[model samples]
Target chain A: DTAVSQTPKYLVTQMGNDKSIKCEQNLGHDTMYWYKQDSKKFLKIMFSYNNKELIINETVPNRFSPKSPDKAHLNLHINSLELGDSAVYFCASSPRTSGRAQETQYFGPGTRLLVL
Target chain B: DQQVKQNSPSLSVQEGRISILNCDYTNSMFDYFLWYKKYPAEGPTFLISISSIKDKNEDGRFTVFLNKSAKHLSLHIVPSQPGDSAVYFCAAPCGGNKLTFGGGTRVLVKP
Candidate 1:
């Protein structure tokens, strides 16, 4: 079974259009995350939710918002997307444990977004 | 600033040879390190990991080495096969529930 999955494997939209990418994990993990991989293949964490609570919010702009309905799902919504929004968005989840640093994350296939 | 840095952008190796990928970190607070393999059109998959307390960790043909004093880490794949060609990312726990990833090194295993 796919442990982590994301919808809309590819998305192409015009500038100023809004889009949303959904993510779900069946690993029963308590923490979910949204990451952005740029053209340079640099992966950066955008947001993280622990037990449906916002825990990590990076330097991402307000145009991007992440919502976690429960421990199993985390979705990302982009408002008025721009050309700079073109990149691959990845969703990941990790089990909550006492050793937070030692936790391993599982990532979904990712959503490729293109804004013309 | 990029906390984790993989200076090598690409590496090519012959099949059945050892492929070494290196990563460096500027943050001393990072206690755990991980290596992930990613292919085109797919997300990264966890390959191996090593803790700050240990210098090395091995799993099958994959091994990760950590140098706390130098704040460096390396991933070695022995007897690399063509199927092992992919982008390798080195990551560290940035704090709380976040991870700081490197720029990634693309490995090409030549048959």
Candidate 2:
């Protein structure tokens, strides 16, 4: 069984269009995050939610939003997608520990977004 | 600015040889560090981790060494196999639920 899974493994959209990627984790983790890997293969964190609460918001644009309805799911919605948005979107989950952050994040297969 | 950096973009090793992947971080606030391995078409998987309190952590054939003073960390894989070929990433927690990842190093283990 896959611990973390994402829908629409591949997404091809056009500029000025909007799209959403869904992520779900069965590991019962308390924190979920979204990361973007550009063509240069630089992985950077975009957003993070702890128990459905927005905890960490990176320098991502306002056009990108992350919603976590519950602890098991976190979805990313992009508005007016641009060509620069062509990259791999990865969803990750990790258990929250007391005081110290020693948890290992588990990542999903990732959604390859192609903006044409 | 990128807090974490992997200077080496790629490395090649022969079977039964040791593979050493290095990483460096500029942030002193990071208390925990981790190494993740990724194969093509798949997401990165956690391999090993080392806490700031400890300088070294070993798990079977994989060992992680951290030097807080130098802000450097390295993952050593003993007797690397062809199956060990993949992209390895170094990561550190920037804060609550936020992890800063390195540029990644692709390791190719040949037979």
Best candidate (score: DockQ): 1
lDDT of each: 0.93, 0.93
Note the chain A TM-score of all models in turn. 0.96, 0.96
- Provide the TM-score, chain A, model 2: 0.96
Q: In candidate 2, what are the lDDT values of residues A7-103, reduced to their tens digit?
A: 9899999999999999999998999999999999999989989899998898999999999999999999999999999999999998877754436
Off by over 4 Å in 2: A99-102
TM-score of 1: 0.97
Per-residue lDDT value at B23 in model 2: 99
lDDT of 1 at A75: 97
Model 2 vs. true fold: TM: 0.96
Winning candidate number (TM-score): 1
* DockQ of the two-chain complex in candidate 1: 0.83
lDDT for B105 in candidate 1 is 96
Q: What is the C-alpha local distance difference test score of candidate 1? A: 0.93
lDDT for model 2, please. 0.93
Label model 2 with its docking quality class. Answer: medium
**Model 1 C-alpha lDDT per residue in residues B12-56, reported as the tens digit of each score:** 999999999999999998889989999999999999888888999
